[model samples]
Each structure stands twice: as structure tokens, then as C-alpha cells.
Target: MPNDLQRFVFVLFDGFSNMVLASALEPLRAAKGLPNGPAIDWNICTIDGAPVTSSSGLTITPNASLSQISNKADIDYLVVVSGYGVRDHGTAKVRARLQNAAQHARHIIGIDTAAWILGCCDMLRGKAATIHWQELDQFADQFPDIAVSQDRFVQDGKLITSGGASTVMELMLHILTQQFGPAVAFDVSNLFVYDAENQYHLIRGADWLQGSGGDDLRRAVGAMMSRIETPVSLKDIAKQAGCSLRSLDRVFHDNLTMSPGKYYQMLRLGRARDLAQATDLPLSAIALQTGFTSSATLSRAFSKTFDTTIRTIRKSRAIR
Candidate 1:
């Protein structure tokens, strides 16, 4: 709606995650807040231009109906934000509206369960996309034509799909980087206190570790992260990070209140937890991926750290 600005249209549906919507929109908001920043305009829209309710019982009023913007050249991107019970609310009219919008928009991005709708419309055919981890199995099975990834976000061709929430922030930052520059993106990340290294994949409790510790700590953690599948020894981690084993131990003690080995194990276990929950991969495969020598080792470490077995966690999530 603003003049001479990069325009984005976000299609909201019932039960959408407010966090995902905010994470995607906030970077643009931060950019606009910057002094003499370039213009970037966005509008919330629905199929019928009505108010939509989020999963958390929050209501959002759309700026315009999907049909109102027929001149696709005016819009830079169209994103669909849906959640929880998306399948229940999606109608033929909604699909038709998206199909019409896809004809005009430069790119179509899907968040959370929106990929399911996009797949239903046959828009993701031959494209690599990702959806919320919980739906990955169903998505792959339901749409044989789509290439699904477990990455937090996937941008294949003109189509972009994000897993959800925090991942949406990464997607938005990427969009900003493309539209403006890395400086703008970096500044925007600072505004949100976001860690860019945690882009699509990240450690579980490492968010708090960001910028609090010294560079050596960050470097050591980075090294550990980069070698999750084939874990490097602590001596190697310290050496590559330009620190002694004792120095690395002290840094971890001061920052994370644990030894470097324990912290790195947690990181690997975190990755194992993610893979175990998000993927249909076998326990043995997950073990190798997360640096455990065997499935039994992974199970023992997982139970020790989380106080629950990986199988139990997966089963509970499956039941939910």
C-alpha cells in the first residue's frame, strides 16, 4: 500500500501461529524504523478480507481481500501463514484464490501447514520445500511430487517454505538480505537480538550463549556444531578455536556452567532429539548422525540428559 516500496502480501488463515507471522513481519518493521531506510510495505490479507483467528485465540483483521490485488506486478511476494487445523479450514475457494494469486505474485512462500495447501494445489511439484517437522512424514507421503526437507527453511526456485516461528525469522532476514543488503539484515538481527548462525539448524540452549561469552566460546561451539555427525575431540575443538583445552574448559564453565565435553554432548543430543522427533529415520541412523557410536549410546545419553527416552518422546509427540 505504501508508495514505491517492496510489497508483500501475507495470507492469513484460521489457527495460524502468531509467532510465525510476527517473526516474518518484524524485520521489515525494524527496517522501516531505521533512519532513512528503504521502503518495504506489507499487508495482511485473507480470501474474503475478513478477520482471522489465530490458534492462540488472537484475532487479526486483514487489509484487503485476495481478489483486490489483481495486478501481480505490484506485489513482490505472497506468503501463506496457517497452523494447527489448516486442513480442516482449507476450502476449494481458498485453493482457487491461492492459485489466482500465484499467477500474479513474483514468489509464493509457505509457512507451517501452508505447504500442505500448496501441495494440494500442486504448486510444490518438483520443488524442494519444508513444512513443520510434525507434518513432514505426512507431507512426503501425501505429495510424492514434492521434495521435502527438514531444514528450517527451503528456498527452491521462486518458492520458499519455512518450518515455523523462529525459522520464519531466518527466512525474513534472508529476504531482507536479498532486498537491501547484509548490513541491513545484520542490523535488523541485532534489533531482534537474533543469532544468525542459528539460521535453519541450531543448538537447543545455545540461544542464551550468544554474545554473552567470549569469541573463543562461540568459535568452539561453532566447531562442535559443524562436526555434529562426526564429533571432534575437545582438544581439536580448542585447537581449531585458537584456544587451549584448559582455556576452552574455563570458558564453558564461566558461560554455560558446564565442561566443554558436557556442553558439546548436549548439543549433539539436541540434534539427536530433533532428528528423532522430526524424521522417520531409524535410531541407529540418528545415532550416527548425532555422533553417538551406537543406538544404545544415544538412548542412554538421551535419557540421561532429557530424563526421558527418545522413543518415549517420539511416541508422546505422535500421540499428540
Candidate 2:
């Protein structure tokens, strides 16, 4: 693998959703357009390196074939993009090709119902994964061993599965942030106007506080997310939000149906959970990073909020 370039191969199936493909592919293009940008190379691929028809009747020409990349050693990510009729095109040959390519890739990503294909190949077994919400029941029933979730996306080690096209952009931003830095990722997001979508919350997956509201409420939520590593008190949060404590509490209750204190706890817990699942950090380090005084405190709060132990969550994310 060349250290100068981060190469990605997007395996697009017949009848794939073009929107989903674009969501995952466009961010790399935008990221590379930045000044002194990172060297990110990507290719659209298919089973035979031929033009494949999308669900909306558009055809995309493949840059490489499955046979061409199965033995390659320079690939960094292999993203499978599928949506409607994913099962019809998930042939045995494609599964085998993906399995072989996994040996040389750094990470494997599943967009939309592509997780169904990965699950069928036994590639997602014992990993934290998710699919589109509409297919949650079927996906769970089909892949019993995989820890399925309704989350926007789940990153267990080198495996990543996103819910659908809506969340795929966030997944790419996360990859950029992890590889380059938040500054580049933020700039890429700004170019796409994605940062303004969530009112610049930056914590995209926490849906508990999502809604159209006044700036005071948005500022409070932003403050809570920003201070996860060194938490400020509710009074301080309200002050930063330019609102009184009672007003902030009312805003939280009206929008999220939870008090500011409860929402802040959820934010911290969500960050802690993300770190626990995605990184190899020790519990003490995660606790400190999330503003808990000690590991024991984090443990108790985590168990109480999630109704499961942190050890259990980490165990489920153990990859083969």
C-alpha cells in the first residue's frame, strides 16, 4: 500500500441506488479539492468492470473489475454500495471476491442494504452493524450473530455499516476526520453545506435533540456537545446559550422531552459509547475523556443509562 494515497474501491452492484453511491463518493472529491489536500484515490467497481444499471435506470461505468482487485494489496477501503434488490445481485462470486479483497484492505464499509450482502457472506458476524431502518427487523432476523442497531452507523474495528444514503456522508466525514484531522473534515463539510444542516451541532447521530427550535436551544446543545471532555454545569451551559436555567430547561423539555441535565448525560454517554466501540482506549481513558471523574463512575452511569455494562459492549465489538 502506498502511504501517499488513501485508495478506496466502491463495489457497486446492479440496481444500486445512485444517491447512496454519490453520498459515499462525493465527499472524497470535495476533500481533495481543498488546499494542500490529502491524496485520496477512489474507483467505482463492479463484478465484471462493466457499466451497471442503477435502480433509477442510470448506468455507471466501473473503473475496475472484481477479478482485477481481488488480489491487489494497495486498497485502503472496500465499500459496498447497494440498496433496492441487493439480494438479487449479491451473487456467490461477488461474495467470494469481497472475502478475498478483505485480506488486503484496511476497512470494509457497507452502505444502505449492503450490510445484507456482507451478512450473507458471514463477513459481519459478531460485529456491530446496522442497515436502513425499514429493513431493521429483516436484517436482525437474518443476521442473528451480528449485533444489529438502529444507529445511523456502527463502526466495529475495520468494519463500518451505515443505515442509508442519509448517513453515508457523515460516515465519510468521520473517516476523513480520523485520517486527516477535524480541520480538513470540517472544511469539507462546510463546502457541502452539511455543517449548517444540523446547525453546526457536529454531533450528528444523537437524534434525541433534533428539531427546529430557537438559537438559544441550539447553542445549549452545541455547548453540551463541545464540553464533553470537560463538562460545564447547567448554569454555565445556560449562560453560554444566552438563556436562564429555567428557560433552557423549558426549551429542552419542549423539544426533546427531557431536561437539559438528562440531555447532557445522553450526549456524554453517546460519546463514551462511540469511543468504546471505535477505539482501543482503556475504560479509564474513555471515562476521563468523557468528563467522568473515574472509570467506576463511568461504569455505573453507563450501565444505568444503557442498561448494559461497558465490558459487554466492548465484548460484542470483538472482531475475529
Candidate 3:
């Protein structure tokens, strides 16, 4: 077998989210176990060699200090994992390291709140990206030059940014699929128990919800969105909205041009797509988690609505 170990370096900072770090690392570990043995080599690093503590109090000792790394040309990608103290951690030295690394690495990936750090370094200037939802407003307010969205993940050429902890898995899966064949990525996903096939929303442009208008419609939409995984009946939704079922139906039809049931199904399918695309979860698991009665039911419904099978969707995402 050819030595195809893809080298990856992850830079962790103080108060980073451990789940985000795991989500990024686990897929690579699984990929290493592919048919020909380990296919990837990864190393953890910190700005300093000192142990770094995660937001949840998990401590990890880096393999090396960022300042000690030699030729960057040996690395395939440099991923920066950022969280709570993103602003404090974005010191001049850290930014300089990132800027210098970007010059040699094939791509730069930012997880969780690190996208803000990338934006601060001017790496994301005029690039489309996404960060954790909590930081969206402030990130946009601060980096007006970059196009920010609410997507699970966004990849613009060599720069990639993910929105949350789970998004890291999706981003890595995307990279794996691109480097290896979709079949190998799918096998790696199965080893990790992730759903090998899923469609993730990458473009979160403002126009996504163009038809959803007014405060009442927005509230109704929010209620519908929150219940996608375990949808409630229209009467129950109406009670939640403090309005009659007829009134709610009329509002949905007028603004969104779809029945509440249909809209709710769309929301559930969207969630299903995200779960399927990012992880190695089973179709049945995705269906159950997203509120489908059974995998068979979900397959029929998914095919009818999206004009494709769930398996096909998952395979396409895995390869892409």
C-alpha cells in the first residue's frame, strides 16, 4: 500500500471546547484505520508547550509549542481550535503564527469560535464563513468585510469554518471524502459510528428565509423549528401560539405558502440531512432522531420530497 498519511496539525488554545477538539480528531483516527492501516498523521499543539484546559475543565498537553514547529511545508492543514477566550487568545504572536502557517499549509480550518480569530487575522477577509451561533451577531458586527452566515459549515477555497462542536465532524468528513474515495470515507465514518451519508447546509445566505415575514410568522416558524425532531400536532402548535388552528394555518399559508405540517416536515428533513452528512449515524437513527416513524417511512418521504434516496444523499456528501 502506498504511504498516504495526510498530516494534520491542530492548534488548541485556553478554554477550548473539548467536544469540538474530539469531533475534529476522532474522524482522522478512524481514517487512519482504513484498509491499508493508518492513512493520516495528526499532532496537537499550543501557543506555548504548557498544558491547556478546555472550557469543561479537560486538560491536554500539546506535543509541541507553536513557536517550535519547523517547516510548515510538511503539513497538509493547520486547524485552529478556539472557544471562550478567543479575544484574549488572539495575541500578536498567535496571529503571526497563524499568518505564517497559512502561507505554507494547503488549507486553514477554524472550529467553533475560532472563525472569529481567523477573521481578526484577515484570513477571512471577503471570504464567506460561519461561526458558533452565539458569536454570529458580534462577529458580523466586527468583521463587516467577511460574509458570515448561520450554516453548519462553510468552505471557501482553502479556508474552512464550522459553526459548532458537531460541525467539526462534518468539516473533517468533507475533507476526508475529498482526499480519499467516498467509499473509504464511508468506511471510516462507519468505524466512528457516524452517519456516512448526509447533506449539510453550507450556504446560509440571508435569502434562505425570504418568504418568512413579520413577527407572528417568525414566532410560528420558530415554534415549528424547535419541534422538528418531535413534531407536535397542529392543535398543540396553535395552543403554543395562543391562536386557533385555522388562524395559524392561514398565517403559514399566506406567508410561507405551505401547510404547517409540510413546513414542519421540511424542518425535520433539513435536520436529518445535517445529521446524515456529518456523522456515521445509521439511517434508522437519523430517522428516529429527526422524528420519522421508521427508516422505511423516512426513505419514502425523503425520496418523494427531495427526488433522491437517503443513501444516495449520504454517499454524495461523503464523496464531496
Best by TM-score: 2
By TM-score, rank the candidates, best first. 2, 1, 3
Candidate 3's TM-score reads: 0.59
**Residue 265, candidate 3: alpha-carbon lDDT:** 80
lDDT of 1 by residue, 1-320 (tens): 12358888999889899898998888899877553356888888888999999999999888889888645345688989999887775578987888888988888999988999888777999999999999999989999889999998999988999888888888887777677754456446645653424441342223333323456775776688789899989999999778889999887777545698987887688678778778989999999999899999999988887777888868987998
Higher lDDT: candidate 1 or 3? 1
Per-model TM-score on C-alpha atoms: 0.60, 0.62, 0.59
lDDT of 2 by residue, 1-320 (tens): 12378889998888788788888888899778554468998878887788888889998888779668756656789898888887786678877888887888889999999999999888899999999888899888988999999899999998999977778988888888777765456556655653233545454322223344456776776687679999999999999888899999887776556688987887688778878888999999999999999999999998998778878878989943
TM-score (C-alpha) between model 1 and the true structure: 0.60
RMSD of each: 17.0, 15.8, 12.8
Query: Could you tally the backbone clashes for each prediction?
Result: 0, 0, 11
